[model samples]
Target: MVGGMHQRKAEMARHSDCFIALPGGYGTLEELLEVITWAQLGIHEKPVGLLNVDGYYNYLLTFIDKAVDDGFIRPSQRHIFVSAPNAKELVQKLEEYVPVQDGGVAKLNWTVEIEQPPPPPTPASKQVGFPALKKAEIAL
Candidate 1:
């Protein structure tokens, strides 16, 4: 019974094994960035991935690198998320993702002891219903 928007997001993040942001506008980017920030702060160890279908996120990726180069984003925090062009590969990258151990910039109201990641995604991992997602932007 999550009542607020941010509350719902937190609830989902708590329950989710991984996060996969679909192709969309500001809301998608906001959530994606929030999760990455969480990982950077050692708040959680969940895998964050971006499904970069059809290069939709190419400029955004480049911008992120630029931020790294310009010192806006620390190099240590740059690799917090993984990306791929399709769902299968994205999921695989997610499966193999290792959380970054960054000393976060922002403080939070609550503390969560990051859990150990799940075992690797098996060959039978659920990689379905994503064929239509071939041209979407993502953050997982």
Candidate 2:
């Protein structure tokens, strides 16, 4: 009974271990929503994350919020999707995701946890061999 779309869903369903979604078009939205529906139905358990580079998904995330407020979606559904500004942060969020049970849905905390931050850069004053220049004086 699995058609082309079902086959695609199967591919996604098979990989229900780790999920990462990047900014995309209609196909991306459909994939994300279907996976989330499966999660809500207790058919799969996975960590789903969004890599929102350059504010791409800002509006979509907000629309999901509106969906919840308008009673078209449940608040617990928010746990199925998370948005991160970059790849590293997205991975970190996925790793730290904690699943919670609501009704029959597997929900994540949705609180971002940042780890493995890049080392802080050395301040200019602490760097060796750079002569400090006085403020540039301009001729009138």
Candidate 3:
């Protein structure tokens, strides 16, 4: 049966052996990130990998690199997510993951929220309308 994020956390805490994150949505990202956080904090030591089917995770890999560059995440921490465009290499990385000290994580008081740009404002009152087609110029 499907469960909530909390339940999934408990499940992961129970496993603590291996995890494979395939192409997924928000929930997948959340679960993988949490496990990586636990590993960073030394709470758990496990392997995490991304099966980047059809370049699904290319953008995500770039974002993680940006995270490292922006100092929001560490370069070593980038090891937490192994990216492979195919299952073979992905599984291999997961099999070979070796957990080492991630140093420290500064606790930044922050709130997590998904941001989406607002829609553009509408014109005053549809003032700009399509040109009226002339009956004489119309072709069947």
Candidate 4:
């Protein structure tokens, strides 16, 4: 099992192919932003998303738009992730999602800082969990 929050996060990053954030407090926001930043840095090619339940993240979305408007963030980089109001739509988006290959931001090599050794491969007969998720993972 993982130790502190950081170790859990490292493990999560190691396993997940996609991330979808739910409405919550600071920790939720931090995890969402960090994963998005990881995509920006080319640390991972995972698709990130938000479940904007009841418009909870409207302000945050607007602020991100303003950042693009103010030139603090690039226009292409602004669409770093998809946002939807529910799980179904979010999953659909994640399925259709594509990683930003040329967002103009320099792809940073954060390898040494965030890399974790991979878990040993499980034997074929001992396979557990969905060997093939026809889908994704939520970040909450």
Candidate 5:
């Protein structure tokens, strides 16, 4: 087994060219989400897929659709991952995926302008109370 959970995930992500999620519980879901987030952030160009055997992921798919409808997820961003009913189809979809060129243009900028507040004045070193400790005094 890998030495640590994060180390395992990093190593997996580094070595993987694609990510697929089979029917599973929380760990599986978490891994799927992490890979998808990495793709969204341009950390990697790997394809992410879901194998929806026996309609196992139907509810999750519906939830994703709801998210898109609710505007929490952009419609273009929905193409970041693919889903299919079986292994063969899912794999085929992954094999055919082409990464989006520029995270897709945002449908709306959604910027809000508010009255500006002035920055807080910086406190002097003397006002901080304690003196800086030696490097050795700090524990890891």
Candidate 6:
């Protein structure tokens, strides 16, 4: 098993050329958002997709559209992912996707910047420790 979820996610993303989120619960949503976020940050150029599967993701897709309308998400950024009602369509969409040179430049009236937040303060009572383990102990 993977040592942790975060590490597993990173490994998966690194190995993947594209991402397709199937209909699932909270974990699925979280993973989908994380990959999209990484794409937004210019960390990866992979195409992300959603297999709608009987319109399961319809509400979520609508929410994303609402976010764009509310100025929270730029219209161009919406193209970061594509959705289709079935696996074949989604796969075809993904295969046809081409990464834009400008990283999907949004015609927004504002600028986007990466902000670094200050590190969290460590508690005085807790002691940080590292454990030695074999690489095979973790798998994604």
Best by TM-score: 4
Ranked candidates (TM-score, high to low): 4, 1, 6, 5, 2, 3
What TM value does model 2 have?
A: 0.67
- 24-111, model 3: which lDDT tens digit per residue? 9998998878877767776666787788899998888899899999999888888865778888888888888887565675433222
Candidate 1: the clashing residue pairs are: 19-140, 48-140, 49-140
Give a tens-digit lDDT track for model 5, residues 14-72. 78889999999999999998887777766677899999999999999999899999999
How does model 3 fare in lDDT?
0.73
Clashing pairs in 4: none
lDDT of 3 at 85: 86
- Which is the winner by lDDT between candidate 2 and candidate 4? 4
lDDT of 2: 0.74
**Model 5 local distance difference test score:** 0.79
Q: For every model shown, what is its TM-score relative to the native structure?
A: 0.72, 0.67, 0.66, 0.73, 0.70, 0.71
The candidate with the higher TM-score, 3 or 5, is 5
List where candidate 4 sits over 4 angstroms from the true fold: 103-140
Tens-digit lDDT track of model 4 for 1-140 = 85568668867988888888999999999999998888887878888999999999999999999999999888887778999999999999999988888856666654345547768777874776873563354322
**Candidate models: Cα lDDT each:** 0.82, 0.74, 0.73, 0.84, 0.79, 0.81
**Number of the top candidate by lDDT?**
4
Winner on lDDT (1 vs 5): 1
Error (Å) of candidate 5 at residue 76 is 1.0
Deviation in Å, model 5, residue 91 alpha carbon: 1.3
Best-first order by lDDT: 4, 1, 6, 5, 2, 3
Model 6 Cα displacement at 70 (Å)? 0.7
**Two-way lDDT contest, 1 vs 2, winner:** 1
